[model samples]
Target: SFCPDSDLIRPHRPVNPAAASRSHQELHKELQRLSQEGKTELQRALEKRKWEQRMKASRDQEEAKKSTSPLHQELLKRHQRLENVLSSHCYCCFQFLKLRQIKQRQLLSIDI
Candidate 1:
C-alpha cells in the first residue's frame, strides 16, 4: 500500500550506534573525572576557608588585645564543626569510589 507520507518508513528517527556509544563513553569518563576532582577541590577549599577564618580570628583578637575570650571558645567550636564536615565528606567520597570500582570490575568482567 503506497501512502502519501511514505517517509514514515524511515521511522522518523535514525539510530547511529557508533555515535551513541562514543557519546556515552565520553559522558561516563567526564563524570568519573569530575567526581574525583570534585572531592579534591572540596577538601582544598575547606582547608583554605578554615585557615582564612582562623587567621582573621587571631588578627582581630590581637588587634583588640583581649584576654581568653568566650568568642574565642565559640570560634573553636565552629572550627571543629568545619573539620567534622570535611571528614564526613571525605568518608562519603571514599565509599563512592569503592562502589564505583566494584561496578567497573563487574563491567570489565562482562566485557571479557
Candidate 2:
C-alpha cells in the first residue's frame, strides 16, 4: 500500500556477512574471557572466606583451651595481685603529696 508517510520509513541497509561474522566472533571471545575472569574472582573470594572462617575457629579453640589451662589461671591471679599492689602504692603516693602540699602552705603562711 502506498502511503503518503512511507518516505519517512527508511529501508534497512544490507549487512555485510563477513563483517557480521567477525563481530560475532569478537563478542563471543569477549564474553568467554569475562566469564572466566568472573569465575576466577568468585573462586578466590570463596577461598578467602573459607580461610578466614578456619582462622576464627582455630583462634576460638585456642582461647577456650587457654581459659581452662592452669598456667593461664595462675597468670590471671598474678595480674590481679599486681594491679592491687599498684593501686595501693598510688594511694600512698597521693597521701604523701597531700601532706607535702599542706606543709608548704603552712611554711608560706608563717613567712607572710
lDDT (CA) for every model shown?
0.85, 0.87
Query: Which stretches in model 2 have alpha-carbon errors above 4 Å?
Result: 1-66
Which pairs of residues clash in candidate 1, taking residues 3 or more apart in a chain or in different chains?
Answer: none
- Please, what are the lDDT tens digits per residue for candidate 1 over residues 19-100? 5798887977866786777665466779999999999999988976756678897998999999999999999999999999
RMSD of 1: 32.6
TM-score of each: 0.40, 0.47
TM-score of 2: 0.47
Candidate 2, 1-112: lDDT as tens digits: 7586776776689997765898888977876786877675467779999999999999999989766778878998999999999999999999999999999999999999
RMSD of each: 32.6, 14.6
Candidate 1 global TM-score:
0.40
